[model samples]
Target: MPYSRHLGPLTPPAWHRPWFRYIDAVPGAEGAPPAPDPAQSAQTPPADPPAEPVDYKAKYEEAIGHSRQWEQRAKDNKAKADKFDAAEQEKLSEIEKANLRIADAEKASAAVAAELLQLKAANANGITKDERALLTGTTEDELKAQVAAILKLRAPSTASAQDAGITGGGSAAPTSRAKTLAEAVAARINKK
Candidate 1:
């Protein structure tokens, strides 16, 4: 009461206006503070913006086209590989055929060499070509047996018996006197 009585004659300052009046006032007042607009204060901005729509069908079609191209390339590569494999298989088969032919030729050569060796051996064993031609046998052993049998059947020479006055074709023996004379002549020839 004492302070109020002392300030009763003084007026209150204009700066003591209410807060709502200042907030409601218009902007650009002469020497006045700017005021906030009620409409701008009542509304709020959005947190995020809306996005444009995407074309999923077109993207899917492009991806499928690329996948098909890759699949076709893979098929082409597989076909090429198969073609090369067939060529290689054919070459291998040809090589096998050539090896078979070589083996047959070697076998034939060995057979011919064996036959030549057998012929040489037969000739060395005193078998004449004409006698061998007349002989009949399939193998070397059988041919040798035939040749031995033929040699056995041949007659002995008669020249020596004829010199001793013993006719080989006859059954008669030399007379004692003729034998004695032949022996004496043989002894004399041996001494000379």
Candidate 2:
């Protein structure tokens, strides 16, 4: 026995009901032929056609499954792209840090070289620890010039006397010699 929706006895599909006409149901469809007149339809009626059952639910399910598979592929591709971007960013940061370290090392190296040059210059010029700060210049010629200036300013102090022996341009009369420091002081006051 065949399954039937109604509780009554099974009836043949041909005797069940008349099939609806698609063209007559929806009017004014674009590029469709005009609906036939009732008089003309009666004179030449369409022949009866058997209806075939269609699995619409199965078709809808198949479409949904296909769509899900594509969505999953898209998500996987996005994940791979995100991972690639993250790795690239990390590499770039490490390279940037390395560059900064190189720059710092270069700065330190330059400072040491300059300090060594200054030490060499000070030692060659016989500059003392106290006078080391007085020296200044980046090149050999400039350093030598500074050294010459320093030496000129630091010349022996004995070259000049604190008090003059003679003050006037004219010859003076001979004076008597004092025997003691007290006598010399008394003589200077008396002369004045």
Best by TM-score, which number?
2
For model 2, residues 117-153, the per-residue Cα lDDT tens digits are 7689889878788867755555566567656655554
Q: Could you give candidate 1's per-residue lDDT for residues 101-143 as a string of tens digits?
A: 9999999997786567547655766766765543444456655
In lDDT terms, how accurate is model 1? 0.63
TM-score for candidate 2, residues paired by index: 0.33
Clashing pairs in 2: none
Where model 1 places Cα greater than 4 Å from the true spot, the runs are 1-92, 134-143, 153-192
Question: Which pairs clash inside model 1?
Answer: none
Index of the highest-lDDT prediction: 2
lDDT of each: 0.63, 0.64
Point out the worst 10-residue segment of candidate 1 by lDDT.
150-159
Residue-pair clashes, model 1: 0
What are the models' TM-scores? 0.26, 0.33
